[model samples]
Target: MRIAFYGSSLVSAYWNGAATYYRGLLRALADRGYAITFYEPDVYDRQKHRDIDPPDWCKVVVYEGTVEALKRVAAEAAKADIVVKASGVGFADDLLLQETMASAGPSTMKIFWDVDAPATLAELKAAPEHPLRRMLPSLDLVLTYGGGDPVVEDYRAIGARQCVPVYNAVDPQTHHPVPADPRFAADLAFLGNRLPDREARVEAFFVEPARRLWRRRFLLGGAGWHDKPLPPNVGYIGHVPTADHNAFNTTPSAVLNISRDSMAENGFSPATRVFEAAGAGACLITDAWEGIELFLTPGEEVLLARDGQDVVDLLAGLTPENASVIGERALRRVLAEHTYAHRASEVDRLFRNHARRVEAAE
Candidate 1:
């Protein structure tokens, strides 16, 4: 089967958090005998900051951000067995969604893959006239990055034909354990860009903890935080590239995962970094959220924190030996059940079942 995925950049992770998720899921699908063509717009300086060249597993088409270019790509995409319009392309999104849906043939399954289901659901709830809400009944399937049953139920309530959550998983080949680097050494480290929805939580889970524990080292990476005030103990390294993520994860005594407000509130939405850090054998401390244990065991494989005080307390009592034990356990768990290969198998099953049902109906 062939898939045409229209999403954020595949070659760049600059400001695009979905890059790794797309790569892992699609590469695994390719390995399972699916042909994929990723269509990404050449905007947001993504082309300038390309992380990886177009890989052999999938063809990537970087088109100019114009109506003519979009129309051409949409026409080409109509040939695929599946057409996916992922949320948050960050450029001409409404136009792209319209073109994708309008051009999809009857035989091609139309998918609205929501990388941020919580935010999208809120939008649909607030604005019933939203384009995606109107298109739900026509869509063959609604696949979410992650939101568990709540997301599926909400989509069903909004008249979606079908809804499924394809949670994020690590590509072990791309994010396995690496030798620790001194540059990323810290008692606790966090890697996330500064954004409105995420900033307050970052302050609660990361910044305030650093302030409370002035003696401990706290390293922060990701773009858009150069000017943000931080405790003297917290070091900021802006925009660590994808290549350095393994090192960043491995070197820290413990890595922190802070979800955006929407994701945390919605629960079951583990950010891609959660698996990436675990894949690199980093002891991870995540904020309290629903359905965390479904991914990683809280006390054994992962650590849970309710707020900055919990983070500070966890760091204060954590030892190198215990951190290593937790990290190793988390790594083993993810490798066994949460790798991209595992996810791809689930996706393959879903597609096959859906196809059989469609054929029977016909």
Candidate 2:
């Protein structure tokens, strides 16, 4: 199978958090002997600060995000077995969507891979006449990063012929347990790109906890958080690179996972951080959400906090032995059930089944 995927960035996590997901899943697909070509726009300063060098198995084609460029890639898009336009493709999403649809023949699987299903599904509900609604039925499939039952029902309700959740999973190879780095050693740590959807949650779950734990050290990593008013005990380390994710997760006493409002409301959705942190055997404490039990068993495998006070109390009360035990449990759970290899196999099976079904129908 030849898959042409258009996503935020494959080579650089930079400002694109989906880079890890892309790398893990695509590399797994390549391991299955599928030919994969990832198309990424050369914008958003990602091209300026290139992170990972060229990948070995797949061909990554970076193009200027212009109509002319889209036109040039139409033939290649048409030739592939699947052409996917991921949710947060930044600029030229609409342009690329239309051109990809135009180029894809009946044999090609025109897919919309929604990395942010909660946000996308919310918009579809809020806006009855969303352009995506008109396009959903025309596509071969819709894939999501998170969003359990509600996400699937809503997408189908909104005219999506097929809506599937491909929940975020761990790439054990890149995110397994590692020796701690003293520089990142902290009582608590949170790493996320600062966006409006998540800043308030950060303030409530992360920043406020820092305020209460005056004696304990906290570490903050990610871009756009340099100017936030944080507590004296909190140390903000701007933008920890993808290569250093294991060190960052392993170094902290307990790493924090805060979901955006849309995701929390939707339920059953875990962020990339959840798997990454747990993959490193880091003790995890996340804000309260409805469907988290599907991933981690709270109060046992993972810890839960309802608000600022809950986080503070947990941090203040936790012992090193208890934290280590919790981290180990979560790690075991993730490795057994959630891995990129598992997700990649699912994709392969789904596409194969779809192809076989089509052939039989004829």
Candidate 3:
């Protein structure tokens, strides 16, 4: 199938979390012999701060941030078997959405892949006048990166024909365990960008733990955290590249996973880091979530940390033997069930099902 994705910058992970998910899923689809084109607007200074360049796996079409550019891109999209308008594209102007939707012929399937389900749903609910709400019923399918039963049910209630959750998964080859370098090795390390909505959770789970364990070496990596006050023991390393993510994960005695407020509230939403950390055979200590056990077996595969005290206690008491055991179990579980290959197959099945239904109607 020839699929075209119209969303956020696929080649840039700079400050965009969705980039990892996009790259993994698209590469997996490409491996399965699907021709893919990713359409992205050259906005938000993404080109200036790109983390990963366009890979040979997919064709990348960059558009200017204007109606004319979007119309031009939509013309190309009209030929694709599937066209996806992903959530959080940063440049999804209402005019652009309308143009893209109208340009698709009967053969083209349009999808709205919501990478940030909580925020999107919340925004729509809060503002009945939201333009995307009007666009929802017209979309062929709605897919989300995270969220469980409640999310799907809600999407249906809002008039979507179908909604699927393609949870984040690991790329085993890229994220497997490696020898820990002394530079990245720490007693405890947390990696994530700073966002206002997630700041409180970060403070509770990571910053506070660092304060509690003053004598232990701690590291924080990701963009937008330079000005934040850090304890002397906690080192701030801004923007760790995707290439070095595995090394960073492996270097930590235990890696901390902190979810944003929206994700925690929605439940069942695991970030890409959870899988990445687990894949690297790094013991994971994550803040409590509603459906964590569905992804990782707590106590055996991961340690639950509800507060700073919990984090401190876990770090101080987790023996190397126990950590290794937990990491290995988590890695095994992820490899068995949560990889890009699995997600790609699921997507293919959905596309085939949709195709079958269309044929039946015809």
| lDDT against the true structure, each candidate | 0.93, 0.88, 0.88
lDDT of 3 by residue, 87-188 (tens): 877775566667777878887788888998987898888877777788889898999999999899888877788899999999886789998888797899
Sort by TM-score, best first. 1, 2, 3
Q: Give the number of the best model, judged by lDDT.
A: 1
Span of ten consecutive residues with least summed lDDT in model 3: 88-97
Off by over 4 Å in 1: none
Local accuracy of candidate 1 as per-residue lDDT tens digits, 203-313: 999999898889999999998999999999999999888899999999999999999999999999999999999999999999999999999999999999999999998
- Per candidate, the number of residue pairs that clash is 0, 0, 0
Best of the two (2, 3) by TM-score? 2
**Candidate 3: segments with Cα more than 4 A from true spot:** none
Model 2, residue pairs in steric clash: none
Residue ranges of candidate 2 with Cα displaced over 4 Å = none
> How much is 168 displaced in model 2, in angstroms?
0.4
